[model samples]
Target: EADIYQTPRYLVIGTGKKITLECSQTMGHDKMYWYQQDPGMELHLIHYSYGVNSTEKGDLSSESTVSRIRTEHFPLTLESARPSHTSQYLCASTKATQETQYFGPGTRLLVL
Candidate 1:
Protein backbone atom coordinates (compact mmCIF):
# COMPACT_ATOMS: atom_id res chain seq x y z
CA GLU A 1 0.00 0.00 0.00
CA ALA A 2 1.16 3.52 -0.71
CA ASP A 3 2.22 5.51 2.35
CA ILE A 4 -0.12 8.44 2.34
CA TYR A 5 -0.53 11.02 5.08
CA GLN A 6 -2.94 13.83 5.80
CA THR A 7 -2.09 16.47 8.37
CA PRO A 8 -4.29 17.87 11.11
CA ARG A 9 -6.40 14.75 11.12
CA TYR A 10 -9.14 16.67 12.86
CA LEU A 11 -9.71 20.36 12.56
CA VAL A 12 -12.25 22.70 14.09
CA ILE A 13 -12.40 26.27 12.98
CA GLY A 14 -14.82 29.13 12.98
CA THR A 15 -16.71 30.21 9.92
CA GLY A 16 -14.80 32.31 7.40
CA LYS A 17 -11.52 30.79 8.51
CA LYS A 18 -9.16 29.95 5.67
CA ILE A 19 -7.86 26.43 5.83
CA THR A 20 -5.74 24.02 3.86
CA LEU A 21 -5.84 20.27 4.06
CA GLU A 22 -2.52 18.67 3.25
CA CYS A 23 -2.15 15.32 1.51
CA SER A 24 1.01 13.55 0.45
CA GLN A 25 2.25 10.16 -0.62
CA THR A 26 5.65 8.55 -0.67
CA MET A 27 4.86 5.74 -3.10
CA GLY A 28 5.33 7.89 -6.20
CA HIS A 29 1.86 7.28 -7.58
CA ASP A 30 1.09 9.41 -10.62
CA LYS A 31 -2.62 9.72 -10.16
CA MET A 32 -4.34 11.09 -7.09
CA TYR A 33 -7.91 11.68 -5.99
CA TRP A 34 -9.68 13.81 -3.40
CA TYR A 35 -13.06 12.99 -2.01
CA GLN A 36 -15.51 14.51 0.42
CA GLN A 37 -18.10 12.68 2.45
CA ASP A 38 -20.54 13.27 5.24
CA PRO A 39 -21.40 10.82 7.94
CA GLY A 40 -23.27 7.81 6.52
CA MET A 41 -23.15 9.27 3.03
CA GLU A 42 -21.52 8.13 -0.16
CA LEU A 43 -18.13 9.52 -1.08
CA HIS A 44 -18.12 12.42 -3.49
CA LEU A 45 -15.10 13.07 -5.66
CA ILE A 46 -13.97 16.62 -5.24
CA HIS A 47 -10.86 16.73 -7.38
CA TYR A 48 -8.22 14.61 -9.05
CA SER A 49 -5.00 14.80 -11.01
CA TYR A 50 -3.23 12.72 -13.61
CA GLY A 51 0.20 13.92 -12.59
CA VAL A 52 2.15 16.91 -11.53
CA ASN A 53 0.74 20.18 -12.80
CA SER A 54 -2.37 18.36 -13.98
CA THR A 55 -5.55 18.78 -11.97
CA GLU A 56 -9.21 18.36 -12.79
CA LYS A 57 -12.43 18.99 -10.93
CA GLY A 58 -14.48 15.95 -10.05
CA ASP A 59 -18.18 15.17 -10.26
CA LEU A 60 -18.92 17.05 -7.06
CA SER A 61 -18.86 20.80 -7.30
CA SER A 62 -16.72 22.11 -4.43
CA GLU A 63 -15.72 25.59 -3.36
CA SER A 64 -12.20 24.46 -2.52
CA THR A 65 -9.22 24.44 -4.87
CA VAL A 66 -6.44 21.94 -5.34
CA SER A 67 -2.97 21.96 -6.85
CA ARG A 68 -0.56 19.24 -7.85
CA ILE A 69 2.69 21.11 -7.81
CA ARG A 70 4.65 17.99 -6.90
CA THR A 71 4.03 14.36 -7.67
CA GLU A 72 3.54 13.48 -4.00
CA HIS A 73 1.82 16.60 -2.81
CA PHE A 74 -1.76 17.63 -3.48
CA PRO A 75 -3.17 20.18 -1.09
CA LEU A 76 -6.76 21.38 -1.02
CA THR A 77 -7.43 24.90 0.12
CA LEU A 78 -10.55 26.75 1.10
CA GLU A 79 -10.24 30.50 1.08
CA SER A 80 -13.24 30.92 3.34
CA ALA A 81 -14.71 28.06 5.25
CA ARG A 82 -18.33 27.65 6.25
CA PRO A 83 -20.49 25.35 8.31
CA SER A 84 -21.65 23.66 5.14
CA HIS A 85 -18.05 22.68 4.46
CA THR A 86 -17.83 20.44 7.48
CA SER A 87 -17.03 16.97 6.26
CA GLN A 88 -14.38 14.32 5.97
CA TYR A 89 -11.82 14.73 3.23
CA LEU A 90 -10.05 11.73 1.86
CA CYS A 91 -7.01 11.38 -0.35
CA ALA A 92 -6.04 8.46 -2.51
CA SER A 93 -3.45 7.62 -5.08
CA THR A 94 -2.91 4.95 -7.71
CA LYS A 95 -0.28 3.94 -10.18
CA ALA A 96 -0.90 4.14 -13.90
CA THR A 97 -0.47 0.38 -14.24
CA GLN A 98 -2.56 -0.56 -11.24
CA GLU A 99 -6.24 -0.45 -10.48
CA THR A 100 -5.96 -0.35 -6.74
CA GLN A 101 -5.88 2.94 -4.93
CA TYR A 102 -4.15 3.58 -1.61
CA PHE A 103 -5.92 5.94 0.72
CA GLY A 104 -4.74 8.13 3.54
CA PRO A 105 -6.30 8.66 6.93
CA GLY A 106 -9.00 11.21 6.23
CA THR A 107 -9.04 14.74 7.57
CA ARG A 108 -12.17 15.75 9.39
CA LEU A 109 -13.10 19.41 9.41
CA LEU A 110 -15.76 21.21 11.35
CA VAL A 111 -16.56 24.83 10.76
CA LEU A 112 -18.46 26.26 13.71
Candidate 2:
Protein backbone atom coordinates (compact mmCIF):
# COMPACT_ATOMS: atom_id res chain seq x y z
CA GLU A 1 0.00 0.00 0.00
CA ALA A 2 1.14 3.56 -0.66
CA ASP A 3 1.95 5.48 2.47
CA ILE A 4 -0.15 8.52 1.65
CA TYR A 5 -2.07 10.73 4.03
CA GLN A 6 -4.48 13.66 3.89
CA THR A 7 -4.92 16.05 6.82
CA PRO A 8 -8.03 17.67 8.24
CA ARG A 9 -10.05 14.59 7.24
CA TYR A 10 -13.19 16.62 7.51
CA LEU A 11 -13.67 20.39 7.36
CA VAL A 12 -16.49 22.88 7.52
CA ILE A 13 -15.88 26.49 6.62
CA GLY A 14 -17.73 29.63 5.73
CA THR A 15 -17.99 30.85 2.20
CA GLY A 16 -15.07 32.87 0.85
CA LYS A 17 -12.73 31.24 3.31
CA LYS A 18 -9.37 30.18 2.00
CA ILE A 19 -8.35 26.62 2.70
CA THR A 20 -5.48 24.34 1.93
CA LEU A 21 -5.86 20.59 1.75
CA GLU A 22 -2.67 18.83 2.66
CA CYS A 23 -1.42 15.60 1.05
CA SER A 24 1.81 13.81 1.68
CA GLN A 25 3.37 10.50 0.76
CA THR A 26 6.30 8.66 2.25
CA MET A 27 6.80 6.27 -0.67
CA GLY A 28 8.73 8.82 -2.71
CA HIS A 29 6.61 8.38 -5.80
CA ASP A 30 7.51 10.77 -8.57
CA LYS A 31 4.01 11.14 -9.94
CA MET A 32 0.93 12.29 -8.06
CA TYR A 33 -2.68 13.16 -8.86
CA TRP A 34 -5.50 15.12 -7.27
CA TYR A 35 -9.13 14.38 -7.79
CA GLN A 36 -12.40 15.96 -6.69
CA GLN A 37 -15.63 14.10 -6.28
CA ASP A 38 -19.08 14.83 -5.03
CA PRO A 39 -21.11 12.36 -3.01
CA GLY A 40 -21.87 9.33 -5.18
CA MET A 41 -20.45 11.13 -8.18
CA GLU A 42 -17.59 10.43 -10.49
CA LEU A 43 -14.07 11.48 -9.61
CA HIS A 44 -12.70 14.33 -11.67
CA LEU A 45 -9.02 14.85 -12.06
CA ILE A 46 -8.08 18.40 -11.18
CA HIS A 47 -4.33 18.35 -11.11
CA TYR A 48 -1.28 16.13 -11.48
CA SER A 49 2.49 16.20 -11.61
CA TYR A 50 5.26 14.08 -12.96
CA GLY A 51 7.76 15.13 -10.36
CA VAL A 52 8.86 17.95 -8.08
CA ASN A 53 8.44 21.41 -9.66
CA SER A 54 6.44 19.90 -12.51
CA THR A 55 2.70 20.44 -12.25
CA GLU A 56 -0.10 20.19 -14.77
CA LYS A 57 -3.79 20.77 -14.87
CA GLY A 58 -6.03 17.76 -15.34
CA ASP A 59 -9.09 17.21 -17.51
CA LEU A 60 -11.33 18.97 -15.06
CA SER A 61 -11.25 22.72 -14.73
CA SER A 62 -10.83 23.69 -11.11
CA GLU A 63 -10.33 26.93 -9.24
CA SER A 64 -7.92 25.30 -6.86
CA THR A 65 -4.18 25.34 -7.38
CA VAL A 66 -1.51 22.84 -6.43
CA SER A 67 2.19 23.05 -5.78
CA ARG A 68 4.90 20.45 -5.90
CA ILE A 69 7.90 21.71 -4.05
CA ARG A 70 9.03 18.32 -2.77
CA THR A 71 8.49 14.81 -4.00
CA GLU A 72 6.63 13.79 -0.84
CA HIS A 73 4.19 16.71 -0.63
CA PHE A 74 1.50 18.13 -2.87
CA PRO A 75 -0.97 20.53 -1.34
CA LEU A 76 -4.05 22.02 -2.98
CA THR A 77 -5.29 25.48 -2.09
CA LEU A 78 -8.55 27.16 -2.88
CA GLU A 79 -8.21 30.92 -2.79
CA SER A 80 -11.88 31.46 -2.17
CA ALA A 81 -14.07 28.63 -1.02
CA ARG A 82 -17.65 28.43 -2.22
CA PRO A 83 -20.53 26.07 -1.79
CA SER A 84 -19.70 24.55 -5.13
CA HIS A 85 -16.30 23.69 -3.79
CA THR A 86 -17.77 21.46 -1.14
CA SER A 87 -16.66 17.99 -2.06
CA GLN A 88 -14.17 15.24 -1.35
CA TYR A 89 -10.61 15.79 -2.46
CA LEU A 90 -8.49 12.75 -3.03
CA CYS A 91 -4.75 12.35 -3.43
CA ALA A 92 -2.91 9.57 -5.15
CA SER A 93 0.61 8.65 -6.09
CA THR A 94 2.32 6.16 -8.34
CA LYS A 95 5.79 5.39 -9.47
CA ALA A 96 6.84 6.57 -12.91
CA THR A 97 6.93 3.05 -14.23
CA GLN A 98 3.77 1.85 -12.50
CA GLU A 99 0.14 2.07 -13.53
CA THR A 100 -1.36 1.38 -10.14
CA GLN A 101 -2.05 4.46 -8.03
CA TYR A 102 -2.21 4.36 -4.27
CA PHE A 103 -4.70 6.78 -2.82
CA GLY A 104 -5.14 8.55 0.48
CA PRO A 105 -8.35 8.51 2.46
CA GLY A 106 -9.35 11.94 1.12
CA THR A 107 -10.35 15.20 2.77
CA ARG A 108 -14.01 16.10 2.80
CA LEU A 109 -14.73 19.82 2.75
CA LEU A 110 -18.00 21.58 3.31
CA VAL A 111 -18.48 25.26 2.59
CA LEU A 112 -21.26 26.91 4.48
Cα error, residue 68 of model 1, in Å, equals: 0.7
Give the range of the ten consecutive residues with the poorest summed lDDT in model 1: 94-103
Show where candidate 2 strays beyond 4 Å.
Answer: none
What overall lDDT, based on C-alpha atoms, would model 1 receive against the true structure?
Answer: 0.95
Q: Indicate the residue-level lDDT of 8 in model 1.
A: 81
Query: What TM-score would every model get versus the actual structure?
Result: 0.96, 0.96
Residue-wise lDDT of candidate 1 within 1-112, one digit each (tens)?
Answer: 5699999899999999999999999998999999999976999999999999999999999999999999999999999999999999999999875679889999999999
- Misplaced by over 4 Å in model 1 are none
Give the clash count for model 2.
0
How displaced is residue 108 in candidate 1, in Å? 0.5
TM-score of 2: 0.96
Worst 10 residues of 2 by lDDT: 94-103
